[model samples]
Target: MNFTGQWVAFKTIVYREIHRFMRIWVQTLVPPAITIALYFLIFGQLIGSRIGQMGGFDYMQFVVPGLIMMAVIQNSYANVVSSFFGTKFQRNIEELLVAPVLEITILLGYIVGGMARGIAVGSIVTLLALFFTDLTVNNWWITISMVLLTAIVFSLTGFINAIFAESFDDISIIPTFVLTPMIYLGGVFYSIDLLPSFWAKISLANPILYMVNGFRYGILGVSDINIWQAYGMLVVFVIIGFSVSLYLLAKAEKLRT
Candidate 1:
């Protein structure tokens, strides 16, 4: 496709995905906001009060970044996985495969759409959190960069998962089993500093921990892991996911005969 044609295709896919989620705002957006509010009330207010401060900030402030990132990660991933799999189940993806547009463009377009929704929801959650606490961003660039990169990584991941999913239940497996555990143990509720020496060392192996703390450092200026290392790992994941998603799309891996 020519530049103009590519632009049109990209815009159409993104607009369609955006409208899809926005039209069902209750399902796509409101749930995460409500969930976070509950977290603030229960974990931050009730349990957190007894738990005491972590990494120089109040419990609510420490968790705000992780919560926001969690929303971004989950929604970005869920949006694309479901959106792409729906197209596959309906056989609509064949239309894109048969079109003159390049596969990389198609893949990137959908990923961008997912990232947009993720960032949008995360931003809303952040704004909502502000109403309950006085939060400050220690480094705007790192914060924004990490969030964007994390969204893109998960968005691409969702696309890849969709390619391999064979049923509706398949789509839910990763989020339920893998993603949920990662987010919960990802240093969201407590600091690694408080963990036993052995457990703290083991937690380092969880990649999500890096992202959670990296974002926390960006907001609260503190982290259990090196902030730069977190940024590096996220960039690497983006590159790897983008490359693999492009390859799958270009080859029409599961979509074409």
Candidate 2:
């Protein structure tokens, strides 16, 4: 397809994705905001009071950025996986395959859709957080860039997961088993510096740690991980995720044909 044709296709897919979640805002958007609010209340207030400050800031402050990142990661991944998997389940993906749209255009459409949800949910979570603690916003660039890039990475991964997913059950497995564990341990609740020398080293292996800390640095000016290294890692993941998602998507189409 020509550039205009591809652009039209991309917009259509993105509009469908945005509409899909927005139509069910109660289910897709509201829950995460409520869940993060609970985290602020229970962890940031009730427990944080007794625990004292973390990473040189109020406990609530320390946790706010991580909570936002959490929302972004979860929503971004969920949006794409569910949307794309639904297309697969309904077998309308064949329509896309036969359509004049390029694969990259389709991929970008879904990624942007996922990004919209992630950023939207993250914004909601951030707004809820304001009721609990003030965000000084140490660096606007890092804060904005981190959230956008992080959302993109997860969206691509979600696209990949959808490509390989065989059943509805398969889509939930990674979020439940892999993503949940990573987010909790990803420096959301506490700094890895608090970990013992040995465990702290192991924590570095968890890629989510870098993202959480990078974003944390953006708001609170503190992070357990180096900011530059975190950006580097995120960039690398973006490249790898995009390449892999494209390959898997092509493979899936070939198999479907």
Candidate 3:
């Protein structure tokens, strides 16, 4: 396809994706805000009161970055998985596959959609967090980079999940069984430093730990892991996830049929 043709196709896909979630703002947008608010009330206000400080910062302050990152990660992954799987279930993905649009264009269109939802939801969570604590950005560059990279990584992951999912239940299974557990143990509410040495080392294996700590470092100027290491991990994951997603997209017959 010519450049103009590709651009048009990309724009159409992205627009459709944005419109899909916006059409149901209540479901896509409102729920995360409410859930995160509850976390602030229960975990931040109630439990955090007794806990006092973590990592030399107010408990509420410390948890804010993690919670925001959590929102971003989950929503980004969910948006793409659900959106792509919906196309497959409806048997319309075949149209895109057979079209002149490049496979990479399709992948990017869906990714951009996921990133949009993730960043939008994360921003809302950040605004809500302000009510619970006076948050500050310690490093704007690191802060923005981590959040964007994390969103891209998870968005690509969601694309992979969608390709492999055969049913609606399959989509929810990973988020429930795998994603949720990792996020909770990813230092959302607490630091790994608080854990025993063995468990702390084990926690290092959870990819979400790097994301959370990297984002926390951006906000609070402190992290359980080196910020550069976290950035490298995120980049690596993005590359792997994107490559996997493209490979799956190339297998259009298997995915669509």
Candidate 4:
């Protein structure tokens, strides 16, 4: 349709998404804040006390970036997957597909929604973290850029998962079995450098590692991997996720059936 039409459609989708999550702030927003606070209390305060320093920062400080990134990744992914799948389950996605809106527009509308939730939740978690440690931004650009890119990548990922999901259980599987492990092993609580040589090399395979390290570098000015490499990978994943999501959306028959 025309530019104005597309803009209206986009705004409607984003507004709906924002409103849905905000309407249930207790579920979407409060849970992450409480969970992160518990992590700070248990991992940062209790265990971190005995662990002392990691990568030249206090254990609590070192984990702040990772925890925030984790919040962004999880919420961004969950928001889109659940929202898109809900549309599918209700069989309302066919309406959007038959409408004049472009496939990319639909993809982006959902993505923007996911990114909004992810960034919002991440910001809240970051604020909560301040109570436990003196967090500083070593590189504002890198920090913000990495977080934004990571959110987009995962938002796209959630869209892909939603397309392939046949049931509600399918949506939970990847996050439980796949995403959780990746995040934990992604260097959220510890650095890969602390791993033995062979295992450290293996950690490189986890995409979350680059994201966590890039974010940590932004916050702490240190990283086990080159920052540029992390930036490149994040961009590449965004492209791949976007392409896959578009392809799935194009298969309207398969999706609607």
Candidate 5:
């Protein structure tokens, strides 16, 4: 397609995705905010009183970034996976597949839409945290980059999930089993430094660990892993996810059938 036509397609997909979530604001946005508040209540106020500081910050302060990033990751993944799968289920995706828009354009459009929701929810969670704890951002660049990269990587992962999904159950499986375990065990509550040596080594293997630590570093100026390693892993996932999603889009894999 020509430049003008491509731009139009991009805008259309983005508009649709944005409107999809905006139309259901309570469903798409409010739950995460409420969930974060509960975390602060249960973990931060109730349990945190006993647990004390983590990474040299008050327990509530230490957990905020991880919670925000968690919201971003989940929402970003859910937005794309459910939206794309819904399109496929409803037979609406055929309209785009038959169009002249480049596969990457469609991917980017959906990705941006997913990231938009992710960032928006993350921002809301951050604001909510302010009510429960005093906070400071130690590294603005790390904070912004990590949030954006995390959103993009998960957005692509969700797209891949959508492509492989044969039913709504398939789409929900990864988030329920895989994604939940990763986020919970991803060092959201305590630093890996607090773990025993063997468990610490094991925790290092989780990709979400790097993301949480990196974001924790951004917010609290403390991290259990090297910031470079976190940035490197997130970048690698973004590259790999983008490539795979593009290929799936080009092939029109489960989407076309």
Candidate 6:
């Protein structure tokens, strides 16, 4: 396809994706906000009070960044995996495969769409966070960059999951078995310093820990992990994920069954 044609195709795919989640605002949006808010109440307020300060800041303040990041990661991944898999389930993806659109355009379109929902839901969670804690951002650029990069990484992962997923159940497996554990253990509620020396070293292996801590550094000016490492991990993931998703997308047999 020509540049103009590719641009139009990209916009159409992105628009459909944004519209799909927005159309079901109650399901796609509200639930995460409510869930995160409850975390702020129960964990940040009730339990946090007893736990005292974490990383030299109020526990609520400390957990807010991680919670927001969690919201972004989940929604971004869910949007693409569910949407693309739904298209496959409906057999509509075959049309795109035979069309003149560039594969990169399709991938970019879905990536942007997932980023939209992820960022949107993250914003909502952030707003709700204000009700519980006072967040003074330490670095606006680091904060913004982390959120965007984290969203892109997970959005790409979701696209990848959708590519290999054969059924709706297949989509849920990763989020349940893999993503959930990573987020909780990724220093959402506690710092790695509290971990035993061996486990703390092991925590270093989890990519989500870098992201959560990077975001926490942006907001609270404190991090257990090096901020530069988080940036490196996110950049590397985006490059690798795009390459993998593109290669998988190019394999027509996967989408066609």
Q: Give lDDT per model, in order.
A: 0.89, 0.92, 0.94, 0.94, 0.92, 0.94
Q: Assess candidate 5 and give its lDDT.
A: 0.92
Model 1, 171-256: lDDT tens digits are 99999999999889889877988999999998898888988898888899999999989988898898999898888877775888
**lDDT of candidate 6 over 1-257, digit per residue (tens):** 79999999999999999999999999999999999999999999999988888899988888999999999999999999999999999989987888999889999999999999999999999989988988799999999999999999999999999998998889999999999999999999899999999999999999999999999999889999999999999999999999999998887568755
Q: How many residue pairs clash in each candidate?
A: 0, 0, 0, 0, 0, 0
Model 1 bad stretches (over 4 Å) = none
User: How well is each residue in 1-257 modelled by candidate 2, as lDDT tens digits?
Assistant: 78989999999999999999999999999999999999999999999888888888888888889999999999999999999999998989989988887778889999999999999999999999989988789999999999999999999989988988989999999999999999999989999989999999999999999999999898888888789999999999999999998877767662285
Name the lDDT of candidate 2: 0.92
Evaluation by lDDT, superior candidate among 3 and 5: 3
Which wins on lDDT, candidate 1 or candidate 4? 4
- In model 4, how large is the Cα lDDT of residue 232? 95
- The order of the candidates by lDDT, greatest first, is 6, 4, 3, 2, 5, 1
Residue 115, candidate 5: C-alpha displacement in angstroms: 0.3
lDDT of 4 by residue, 1-257 (tens): 89999999999899999998899899999999999999999999999999999999999999999999999999999999999999999988878978899888899999999999999999999999999999889999999999999999999999999998989999999999999999999999999989999999999999999999999999999898999999999999999999988988887655765
Pairs with steric clashes in candidate 3: none
Clashes of 1: 0
After superposition, candidate 6 runs with Cα above 4 Å error: none
- Where does the lowest 10-residue lDDT sum fall in candidate 3? 248-257
- Name the weakest run of 10 consecutive residues (lDDT summed) in model 5: 248-257
| Native RMSD of candidate 1 (Å) | 1.1
Cα deviation at 188, candidate 6, in Å, is 0.7
Which stretches of candidate 5 lie above 4 Å from their native place? none
